[model samples]
Target: MKKSFLILVVLLISGMMSAQNGGNDMKKFESQLPQEGRGNVRVAYQGKAIDQMIYEFMEEQGIPGMTLAIVQAPYIPRIVGYGVTDIEKGNLAAAKTLWPIGPISQGFTAVAIMQLYEKGKLDLNDPIGKYLKEIPEPWKSISILQLMQHSSGIADYREQKAFDVSANYQPEQLVQMVATLPLAFDAGTDVKQSATNFLLLTSIIEKVAKMPYHDFVKKHQIDYLGLKQTYFGEDIPNVKQEDVTTTANVHQTFKKDKDYINPSETTTGYVEKEGKLVVAPTISPTSLKGFADIWASAENVSHWDIGLAGSVLIEKPENRDIIYKPTKLANGKTVPAMAGWQFYNHKGLMDIKGNVSGHSAFLSRFTDASELVCVTLLANKEGVDLTNLGRKIAAAFDSSKMGTGANDDLLYTYESLFSVDETMSKIEKVLKTMGIPVFAKFDHGKNAEEVGLKLRPNQVIVFGSPKVGTALMQENPSISIELPLKISVWEDKNGSVWASFPQMNLMAAEYDMESNPVIGKMQELLEKIVIKAASQY
Candidate 1:
């Protein structure tokens, strides 16, 4: 009995110590999270400080692994990874970790079509029937450009109730499933994304190049750019060299080096099951075909993007514009999106993003900024949209040109990770922490109840620094009407909480005080505070 008691006591002490260590580590991590000022976090870039936004995002979203690549003008300054690619094995994610970049493959397909057009082998205006004989008669009349831009009105096979996403389907099988179905609309009347459009494009690519779709993209895009870490679905690229410098897998300060880094294995896909993560069923490469088959490291994906920015890939500026420009319907109205990319209100900002079973991918390009900035994010979690996070990360590099603060939109709203009441409490706490006084709290829901009206969980917090507000009001006294800044937190009908604030830059334009320095500072502060309150640490 004495021996057993001693062993039990030791085990209990060890368990308590382990729990204490874990808690301490978590505290340290939270301390380094992104806020208004800097923290003690270093990343593996050219003396660049770690933003910590990505870390906080992964923690909040329960993401197992992710790879991020940032492109600044002509140089890719940073490519890094966080968390484990294989949760079961606890394998660390790295820059070279391969991920299935869903829908981003459409960009590749579009490039191939453009490359052929540049070669005079195909024309964007040519009807599909000119190259593809197997397509339906209606589809045959659709212009190649229409198909590329999702204006073909083709029935999407993936959307059919009978379709099994896990089944290994050939390109022809997918096309045939929707072949007998009627078009959703006239050939070029409207815009609707369909995987079948890209499938036919793949067939056309095969016919024109006399090679498989993957091989053509490999030869033209991958091989041309010397992207060794890029490959077709499930086909991880091989490493030839033996010796390579490797960054520490966990978050730690990394030394700069010129040596080639060893590539990590592709991340395992995951899906949530009963509030826990489980390995997702492997999706067949054949099923993804032309629309979503490509797998690549975040760094290589951005590298390929750099190639697209110049004449190296497309070779002609006008040809590149053909794909980048929005699609126009027969009614003469141009769609706001093209080739899986959507044009944001911000000038020259465009992005392509989607989920592939158990993986989520995002790529954003700030083309018209003074410096070109591209961000690619690949995470091993399904259904999580990274578009906002990508834009936020870009803003960290150049705040003046990216994110909500500089967005051309009249207002930018953020999705809160908590309920309306909780989100409002967080906002109030942040105000207290920042020493910014809260003037008043308006509980709209409560007010509605008192007035015998119904309202959702809606509330607003009015707060700001008087020093900054005074400085701004000095420039334009009329701005005071909009001053004493307010942030609204409310729950939409869908039960998702959101926080919204006006773009200070737009307000400056309204009041004709565009040159006021306080405007910029106020914009930056509001952005930081909202993000901190809206997101989970």
Candidate 2:
């Protein structure tokens, strides 16, 4: 019964792909695999097919192609589906099909860095430019933590407007993009996401290890883990055919974009569409959006393989029982694969360029449930909507009972949008809308008894001004209905207070974050609302 249900899920994803490309891209979804994905990742279920539910979702939704792999302990890793490779060709996708892993590739570099850390060759807190000297414009020191946490003020790769997608880049070229970028904020003071850090990290991996970045991972992790078929771009070799076969027939080469990859090249062949000259894939803002297609087979794809092949996971190896294990650190000490973000680790999407383009992907691990999931959506065209779909797949194991506990402030806040009366009435409504089953016995905090229940020093999702929406009045005054106001509620341990807020507001539809007037109003309204709510709310 579960197998049948799994097939249904794959078909849905494939169907979604067909709508956008107007091409018949077939998909394959697999569930259930050898227990301990490569050993430690057990498979819970497996499924695959052209019209499977997962594929159908992707196909009908206009997704070009996609792959889903999941694992539950003591079971074989599930190979969800490699939905269509091309919409026009009706090409089917298969498990183990190589798709560029995008940002999750960041995990590989991070691991390689950690391995170096174990060796004591480099410091995670070291300035990135120190490793790559040729970068043109230099910025202030950005600690490894800043890069890892996205706290560095460096402008993002996607934020730059002049970048060219088809242009190739050497690793040095990747470094140059941010060589001169002014720190977005002091390294630790702010948080902003950027791909430049990882690209630079890739370079650091090479500089410190002396071997190419991909080579170090292949020798140290993939090979040691016995993920014979798993490799990054062309650097991985010596794979068993069964381990890496994909029936997805997307052309290995395509109408190449001139700037697609210039400075840094991948193992995959990418030549100039206009000429035979070769260049490495250069990451540019244009290419970050990612291709619509993804590739990978279930053979080596499980959360376990992700743990071994990509970033550090399962910090407590002592917590797991696996038959095979990677080699000890150069110091002859076993390095613990420290876990991060207990329930959900992190997922990333990357565009194809060198070993990196035409592939959109994700990685997730439900640590407490001992479940892990990964999906790769590979195609020749770029798309940004891929994450919307990945999240749905991840939601399956997200364990709603756990409630994302990242910012406690967000979890406890009561003053979101809407009026006090309407908001209070809608608590049950909002909880129901969240999909996760929730029960909130409304206990208004009024008198002494009620006051005890209220958490003081609230988590306030604050904005600086109330004027952003006034300009929207120029476009339409009703916009005020969704005014850019602060959403804050306090929690007090004694009389002390704490603050927290939602990030979604920055990207919400009602507020145009890019527009200064809108942003200012939001800041004003958010602060005013937050202050008012905190004092009397």
Q: For every model shown, what is its TM-score relative to the native structure?
A: 0.66, 0.49
* lDDT of candidate 1 over 1-537, digit per residue (tens): 999999999999999999999999877857458532122123212222345667767875679999899887578888888998888656677888888898999999999999998888988889989998877787888988888889888999888876776787777788888889998988777878898888889988999889988899999999989997888864643532222124333422223332334544677788888768888877677877888888889999999999978898998888887787666677786665788876644567677888887899999898984648899999999877786678677666655445343232556567565678888998999989989999999999999999999999999999988888888777778888997999988776545566888888788889988877777777768877887776531
Q: Write the per-residue lDDT of candidate 2 for residues 112-162, one digit (tens) a residue.
A: 566677677887668776876765444436656456555556666645665
CA shift of 139, model 2, Å = 3.2
* Residue pairs of candidate 1 with colliding backbone atoms: none
Give lDDT for model 1. Answer: 0.78
- lDDT for position 239 in model 2: 29
Give candidate 1 regions above 4 Å deviation: 1-51, 237-261, 406-537
Residue 404 C-alpha lDDT in model 2: 26
TM-score of structure candidate 2 = 0.49
